[model samples]
Target: MPSRRAVLAGISTGALTSLTGCVSTKRTGATPGTDSNTDWPMFGADRMRSGYAPSAAAPRSSPTERFTASLEGTPIGQPIIADGTVLQSTWYGIEAFDAVSGELLWRFRDEEPGDTAVQYQPPAVHDGVAYVGTESGLVALDVESGDEQWRIETASRVSAPPVAGYDWHHLYIGTIEGELLEVSLEDRASSSPGTVRWKRSVYGEIVRLVAPNIAGVTAGTTGGEVYMVYDGRGLWRTKVPGGVTAMTAEQGNSLYVATFGGGVLKLRTAAHAGRVSWHTEVGPVAQGLLVRAAGAVYGADGGGLTKLGTDGGRERWTFAEAASTIPAAAGDTLYIGGTDSILAYKLSGGTGVAGARIDPQRWQYTHDGGYASGVSIADGAVFAAVGDEPRLLAVE
Candidate 1:
């Protein structure tokens, strides 16, 4: 047995409504301590909604060099890496820079329009297309050309980043008011019913990319409802039980739900017609969720951390505020940004991943006054957004 030591490693809202739009993207790198270019896709990469990024970046014990910082506003949205370019959405707009050099690449900007309030989710980009979710509306732009691709809007605001499915045929986004609008990517790019894939309602507003379906795109509602439309032909709705803020992981087999109120549920998508298989209560006030390679489900809350078995319902382990930030897993290692330090854990069952001196030189980063946003792991580096500065830290 392990003593919570042994292996060492590292690292919502609606404003009232506008506050929820500025989501923080936290994930672990896949390949141990190397921040690779590929791997992380969508909020949690997998359908189960686990908030883990499997990159090959080395776990940076400390940041190589801190950057120019985002004075625009705090970076609540996660940073995305595509084709060697890193794109992050701040309260201001979408800013792209070189992943390795930190060179300013390009920026798509916007103003709050009025005291209306602002919420922005990290943009999703691929090939050369970048899709952004802003306080006012959504915009489609060419990643390389920097030319406008298409545009869509809603009376309300958009803070959750856009998730793409249907091979760019359709774009799904959630709003600060809880509206799930479907837009088209056709030559015209209109969200008309013909082009509209589908839409749903969440008694609460949609926060981030913790989407409903596994294709890792079509999002569910904030009211704990999973919206599904078979092949975009018919509509089906199912309610989980609580409001969702973060997506855990999107595995190939099941859909995992991490609720803001509490608990992490594993639902198996039917071989033919999928429905809820079973659900087990893990804990309360679960603000975060994660799944290990061992298939063990984990989550974080105000009290501490808790673990659940993959079998649907079972309690595993819980770590205190000392280990609160959403946990990220890649291979057998787990990384966490805790109240005291950036901790690492080994999932071999012995003790668990913890007990390392990240920034042992000085415990400058604290989770009380501010949150340690989610982690983005690659090769051997960790990217984190912290404080009011909207700073993206690189630890390797």
Candidate 2:
């Protein structure tokens, strides 16, 4: 890909004012979602922040032939697994459900009935602290204790979960106004909010205003700028191009970035964006959702699971098992959620999909939704959320 853009042109102070000014109105639209079980709290399940859920969930049937409910909405966000329960968020507040039984556990509707709304992304939980994001900002609730912690307006909209780790746990996110922020989650977690850790622009010069998707923050900036500041150690502000959305596929020091229009770009995360490792065309995938395992890279691009050969982004296999859901993995199996069905697959080879096992009917038959932004494996079953409805789903 081309090198990062030259120094960012002058950004008028007015733009910042308008962006900050608009933040107040962001809250007027958030849905009030809450959780019942605190075990598998937060977006990634634990504070170490890995998007994997753990629970001894039994699939309805071996090689399940069909899905079960009419839950409604798509799987645009990842689901959290906890105490045999699943938690998810959508345009509504947080919704909790029984993972194995597929039962609604609790719903937190913080929004007023007449309020206009935008989709609020999933939140993260640690030590019982639940963190949910909205168009207005980030809100904190105690999962086990059942209490509100602190609510901070961080953006016109937050499309990703607040990532936590290190002594100074931080909330990483993007805004509709086109900016990136890293706030200290340590504050809310500890009941003491701190100053904004660091803020960066993603437009003009090295930054390209990027509004992340529900998958979370996976960005690669320009001018050799490459950042993935989950914790303080991985914190970097280098330069690369190909604006980053929530979707990211990384292995070792390499970060595979996808864009909304341009396509997937490979960035070397040497903490120095001065070099371009390689470039390949994966189309302008709306989400560059991917994970690496056993020397292979799997992602949800276009509308399926793509198994690629790492060296140059060559396709080894493609499975349209579920459309658009960020593919998740457990052991040797991969889970996919689609508009109407949720599917699972075990790699058969390096040339095309080997085989697929799908739930013939919609797992939650209520609505034809499955943005499957993220997935997790715990105990044995898989946990994910459906889109729109923000219903938590657990399909064994």
Candidate 3:
């Protein structure tokens, strides 16, 4: 596999600047979550939430445990990788570690040492900055030193990760009270701290947000409404059966959504008022998001992991005993977190055999507490945060 730097070198600077608003010339202070090709900057790896890492290859055999670092609190969401560092979000604060050695590098607390300021969403790292959402509001920290760059307090708790626009000049964050705020990242250097570009009201509490492309932002709400806003205008709103748990985009034209009750819906972004191409009842979806890769849509629910055909929503395979967290892909292997182990499965033509058991030949890592957080692959290693225990482990 090619290195991240090598993969990034092939991306035209003009294309990079046009897509993200910042030229990929400077690697030192580039936006925290902007290097999707190499780093798992945010959930689903990129703005489209594909959850697929192209440069990193999945481990063919069982990996050897490298190291595990204890955390201050339980990890609430997935950990992101950037510049050889792993960033994790916990109930207490944000923790960073050396990706290769699992050494504690820096810790950023949103509140005082003793006071508890719960942070449920993972931080989005880009351009040397780590943007995290806490109970108070959105806080930006310098990734290198863990210093506070700026913070914006919101009216309610922020449980969802902040999505960076293509230009990295703006950040769109959703609050627990159903409000979406657009923050200006460019004005942080001035005395103003940061500016609120605009604020919009959605139907319910926004649980997930993603910028599929430069055209607009797709937001999923707890009220079962998915809103697409572009250029500060609400383009369309599509209502699903249950509260939206996760969402992803395909080629900027299709939106894949996973609901809490037990369903996955695919909507056309450019259709007349957003048309539902297909909807399939998977099972009771717990907390994992939907991922699109290898020409199929993969989702995890209370029933386990299910692979659905993207063309017609046909059920291809179902793993009813896997982890409830979202699975990550590298090459043809699918890594999933279970209640007590990290297991790998083979994906043949984007589908697994129904009622098929996990092959012992593949990689498997068992721990005291089950793996709950999403797996991040980089530098030929798999990084995961162990649930219940305050630990993050790297296997290679």
Candidate 4:
């Protein structure tokens, strides 16, 4: 395939603004339909931040490049596949593309001409609106046309991706100032788009958040403090051993938290209190979103992916040389994005001996670019954003 580097020129600020400023840039005008079971709509595939996509028929053998598109900024968050479109969040804004053809559909950048604030969080698509975090606020854009529907400024910078329940009625997020925001999505269809339902003080730098259901939201702070807020009230609060780096929910009541202190803790989200289920040491410093799939929890830290059993948090096997991005698992295969390649590995089903090292390489798709992070799979297709040069690659 020929390089698409020549198409790197960004749309002029004025032109881009017009596209997002209530003007249609190829609006389908069709009401966004419900996403399929295989759609990787948001970060970690769902509001729980679980990076598993069990229904997606991911590639089993060596994957082939379908298409590639150059981007305008360094990609930060993971690629989101929803409603036949792939959305990637970069340092500047979000870029949407045709999931199959890799065509640039529409780009949304809310930054002013000289603003230096960066948008590091990924976007979440619910119903038909895409919720993206800007430097100081959250903006909702029409998924069909890139039209700006509404925006609400936060108390501080959004620290993680905005998440929503299945109904999309309430949006939840954390902030650098230790605030957990619950934004109402009920008014999104009205003339005025959004409303800040409430902002509760978490008392520490809130870094990660997960909304397992509409009534409850779990937030993790930089100080290792975790809180379970239900129905706009703090239901429970607890602390792990280290700074919380990421979190994932299993079966709605169980949460797996990866910490920077070299451990992954399983916590029970009960109505009365947050109880530690199990704490398993992974690497020297465990980080990244915990992935729950095939009856195991996967944590990444220090260039390795560790698989642990869900029953007792026992270490199963470690896949060394894992990349920076979270791995996507479906069925028996794990797809990882490396610096310049996307690799597939055959999962051992956690039946192997504990702490065993394994690397059953299945396939690899290479690109002559920078970091190939944000590996997302949906409907048998894999998508990744190559950072530095900023390019999106589609494979199947």
Q: Per-residue CA lDDT of candidate 1, range 1-396, in tens?
A: 544333233111222233233322222222343445444444444433455554454443334443434434556544666666666666556767666766777766667434433556766665567777766677777775456776666768885667666465556777878777766655563444225555655556765444345343434456776554444332445567677644543446466666655455555543533366567654544454454456566666665556566665566555554345655655545555675345555443332222321222211233232455555554345555555445555555
Q: What is each predicted model's overall lDDT from 0 to 1?
A: 0.54, 0.49, 0.74, 0.74
lDDT of 2 by residue, 339-361 (tens): 65566555333111122112222
| Residue 296 displacement (Å), model 2 | 2.3
Supply the global lDDT for candidate 3. 0.74
Tell me model 1's lDDT, rounded to 2 decimals.
0.54
Give candidate 4 misplaced runs (Cα > 4 Å): 1-37, 187-193, 283-286, 349-352, 355-359
What candidate 3 gets wrong by more than 4 Å, as runs, is: 1-37, 187-193, 283-286, 349-361
lDDT of 3 by residue, 126-221 (tens): 888888888888888888888888788899988678888887767888999987887777755542436776678888889989887775688998
Candidate 2 accuracy as TM-score: 0.67
Taking all chains together, each candidate's TM-score versus the true structure is 0.73, 0.67, 0.84, 0.85
For each of the candidates, the C-alpha root-mean-square deviation to the true structure, in angstroms, is 10.3, 15.9, 12.0, 14.4
Give the per-residue Cα lDDT of candidate 1 at 334. 59
Tell me how far the alpha carbon of residue 35 in candidate 1 is from the true structure, in angstroms, after superposition: 7.8
**Local error of candidate 2 at residue 341 (angstroms):** 2.1
**Tens-digit per-residue lDDT, 244-272, candidate 4:** 88888867588888888648888888753
